[model samples]
Target: MADQAEKLRDMVDKKKKADKTHKVIAVTSGKGGVGKTNIVVNMAMLLSGIGKKVVVFDADLGLANVDILLGIKTKYSLIDVIKSGKKMSEIMIKVNDNLSIIPAGNGVEDIANINEPSFNKVKDELRSVVKDIDILLVDTGAGISRKVTFFLKSSEDIIVVATPEPTSIADAYAMIKIMFLNYKKENIKIFVNMAKNENEAVSVYENINKICKNFLKKEFKSAGFALYDKKLPLCVREQKAISEIAPDGKFSVSMKKMINNIFKENVKIYDNPVKRFFSSIFGG
Candidate 1:
């Protein structure tokens, strides 16, 4: 009886010490102009609509555009957190009650280049601000460079966006190969965008998986796809999320399915992935 009571007490203590669960999903692509940032903005917007507190991190510092897509003007970025001694919350742009945006800054290089003290400051500030959020959706820059892969490597859930074009598929596979072999990232998920039909999307995913299994001895999880929609471009021109403008459109429908798949999957909850992401940025 005494041993059982002690074990129960220990369990209670651990449960009490456990932190709130938050997911960090990085949305990326292999090449530029693959509609990667658009997907990230729409996904974050949709998730926020369903009561999920979401923060969109524009990790593509050089060409950061989450703000442009959302039609919001931002005066500060992550760089300001380090250089200007700004708090993360101060720089964050609140899109709605549940949604916020953090611009990484246009033309800023890898954030890891900052000094150790500044790095720690940014990490701590980031943790304090994101601790209560439900999801951190990172929009990474395109390609396989160190700048792009840094976020990809740090994230627990990575969504690699691709199109049906042969060039797009080949580049996507290359990106997956690097993540799998170089970083040993097995939890990578694929989302096919600009597909003509569901059949084409499935076929593309199958081809990518076949290549992975045969070559890398690994496969990617499907996070669903978006069909080519004329209205999507129109919405983009108007700087509005398709889900907001055309909730019943094909792109919106496909985005809903993808988000459902992402949430339905059983993902292991880390103590705080946002903290992990910041710490890993500087090898903390």
Candidate 2:
């Protein structure tokens, strides 16, 4: 056990010395039940389809459902990586040719409310797993919790998912406000999900943008919208990404457009994925 831990530490140390660059994006929402995880899964699929090496880190912690949503059964999770000294590659479950998933473990409070030391330990274990990835999509839990913000702060960019509902809009604003105040994160991107139409989606984005500009004095980048489609629920029930299940569907098309817009702005790629992953987790 001690030898394995030492090897992991050494691997992290070596990664820290290397230069690797990759895009780190966090997909989060203001509140739960806004189809955030579904959006994340499909986004990964779309990004991977475009020939980008993508890895989805299920950072939803205790309420992890990425694996369930993707219909992939895993024998190990981040818990095993942290507690049992399991290598990250051992825990990562490949979803397809270019996409992989790192489950954060289910009902594990320790992984959710991880302390600095434990976080550092886990970071070491994750370094090698994240190396060489083109895009690291972190699927954070909804709301303004510490865990969510921590992941947001670590990312190169943040995509805030909001629906065309009063409560969701309000909560989304609250989340953006917290991030702006605490982390000085101003370049937040907005994706309006389940909109009735383009106008409804624009209205939703405008509503939040207006509030942030007026009160928080911040503006957000519009990442486009996903129309409310009946097929989405069926896709969820079948535990599959909409992009894979229905590539020509409206939801999949919107997701592809959103991904395109997200990368329109230039992103800074760090040299070392492992180092970048740890730095983001520990606020380094």
Candidates in order have lDDT scores of: 0.82, 0.83
lDDT of 1 by residue, 188-255 (tens): 99999999988999999999889989999877889889999999888888988988887666787677
**Candidate 1 weakest lDDT stretch, 10 residues:** 265-274
Cα deviation of 273, candidate 2, in Å: 39
Model 1, residue 217: displacement in angstroms?
0.5
Which residue runs does candidate 1 get wrong by more than 4 Å? 1-19, 107-124, 265-284
lDDT of 1 at 146: 68
lDDT tens readout by residue for model 2, 80-180: 87678888888899988999999988987777877766667766665676778878888999998877887788787888989988999999999888888
- Clashing residue pairs in candidate 2 are 19-271, 20-270, 20-271, 20-272, 21-270, 21-271
lDDT score, candidate 1: 0.82
**For every model shown, what is its TM-score relative to the native structure?**
0.83, 0.83
